[model samples]
Target: MSSDFYTTSILPFAGIIIKICRAYTDSQEDFEDYYQEVCLQIWRSREQFRGDSKWSTWIYRLSLNICLTLIKKKKNNRQHVVSEYQFVEDTEENQAFEDESLNQLYDAIKQLSEIDRAVILLYLEEKPNKDIAEIIGTTPNNIAVRVNRIKERLKKILDGKIN
Candidate 1:
């Protein structure tokens, strides 16, 4: 990638990468490591982007694929611990919840299945269902239904109702 292209296009996505890593990891160390790897992946794949989808959608898809692939590999190796991303706090501005609540929410999101967490992150980013579906390789209607279920599950988590 050209330096300017990377600076303008890829550099802007650092925070999004961090958020995705946080949603998928638990510890600060792992978060930093995964974030770096995701950046490397994005940079390596930048040339392949053809503007087919929104940049954010493409990045989200890429990050989710990386995390899930790692998860599956780990599982196969009998190392199925929750990722270090399981315990992140929400410190982003314009976030609707307080720190404690946001931490709880992140905790809840981390507990979701990989696909479910991707759906919720899309929802949190205010991406429409159609776009989310496109990013996640699912139908729009299916994404909508999944989003509803995710919301209910989130409510259960926040309300201390998960059993």
Candidate 2:
């Protein structure tokens, strides 16, 4: 991503990107990778922003698409070799919320389908059902039903009845 674009477009919304990446990834390493890819994707897809919705909403959509695609790619390429001389520029920005409930919630979320994860994250972010539907490419009624199902699944996972 271009430095100018990164500062102007991405820095302001870095927290949202971090939160979405946290929901999808298991490690700081994966988080960093997703963050960079999402940044690059946002720069590439900036032209698609027609301003129909808020800028943050567009970033959320892009982050979800890129992270999910990366997940698919990693799943498909299990035989890849490790790179030599890997350098990790560790920073204090990789924050794990210090609440057990939040941790457990994230763990349960990981058990959801890719789209379910996105829906739940937006729901947890307290986004309205209509907005969730719009972001996830579904109807508001569909988002409502799916939210209920996701709640049930999360309850099951929380109660130790399901893995």
Candidate 3:
């Protein structure tokens, strides 16, 4: 990929990519892998963009699709490893959110179904229902309903009312 394209196109939307990938990944390694794969796919498919929607909307769809595909692939290749102990390293991304409430909200989001997770993320990003519908391949009304339901569910989860 050309640096010019990367700088102008991808860099501006890196936060969108990061949020979508982070939603699907449990560890920083998987997050990095997802982020890289999404970026690579975006570069590879740049020519396929027809400007049918906004660039950020396209990126949202692409990032979510890539993360979901990787997740399914990992599930299909699951292995059972019995180990006595495991170690995890704290990364900057993990520490990026210093607010405890923000961390709790993210944890609650992680508990949502894949599609619901995507819906909520886009909603939180303050994307309009029409834009979210386009990215999620749903009707605007459907997205509106889903967003309301997701917000209620998220509130319940955060309030310790539901798991």
Candidate 4:
């Protein structure tokens, strides 16, 4: 991957990428692998962006898809990185959500189904339900219903009613 493209194209929108990777990964190693693969994939496929959605939206969808693929591959006993990336040390912006409450919230989010994780992440990002539905390939009503159920599920998890 060209460093210029990464510095210009991918670096500006890395927060969303990092969040998606963090949501799906459990450890620093896996997080690094997933984060690297996501950056590589985005860098590799940058030309495919045809302006259908905002750049951030494309990054989110691509990041989620890559993470899910890596997860499935890991479940099947095959773990690999598509490409090795030279990582920059995380700046304070990337480390902004290190609070205990946020960690607990992320733990609860991990307990959700993969699709639900995507839904909740996007919802939390404050994307309207309609855009979320479009990205996740579901009806807006389905997104609304699922969002409500997911909130309740999260509440239950946090309250120790469900694990």
Worst 10 residues of 4 by lDDT: 87-96
On lDDT, the candidate that comes out on top is 3
The local lDDT score (0 to 100) that residue 114 gets in candidate 1 is 88
**What is every candidate's alpha-carbon RMSD to the true fold?**
5.5, 5.2, 2.6, 7.2
TM-score of each: 0.80, 0.83, 0.90, 0.84
Decoy 3 TM-score against native:
0.90
Rate residue 39 of model 3 by lDDT: 96
Tens-digit lDDT track of model 3 for 32-96: 89999999999999999999998999999999999999999999998977776865556556743
**Where in model 3 is the C-alpha error above 4 Å?**
84-96, 161-163
Q: What overall lDDT goes with each candidate model? A: 0.80, 0.87, 0.90, 0.88
lDDT of 2 by residue, 77-146 (tens): 8786678875544433443666657777887898999999999999888889988888899899999999
Q: Give the per-residue Cα lDDT of candidate 1 at 40.
A: 78
Order candidates by TM-score, high to low.
Answer: 3, 4, 2, 1
lDDT of 3 at 106: 78
Where does candidate 3 have its weakest 10-residue lDDT segment? 87-96
lDDT of 4 by residue, 56-111 (tens): 88998999999999999899996555656746465544442668578778878999
- Top-scoring candidate (TM-score): 3
Candidate 2 achieves a global lDDT of 0.87
Better structure of 1 and 4 per lDDT: 4
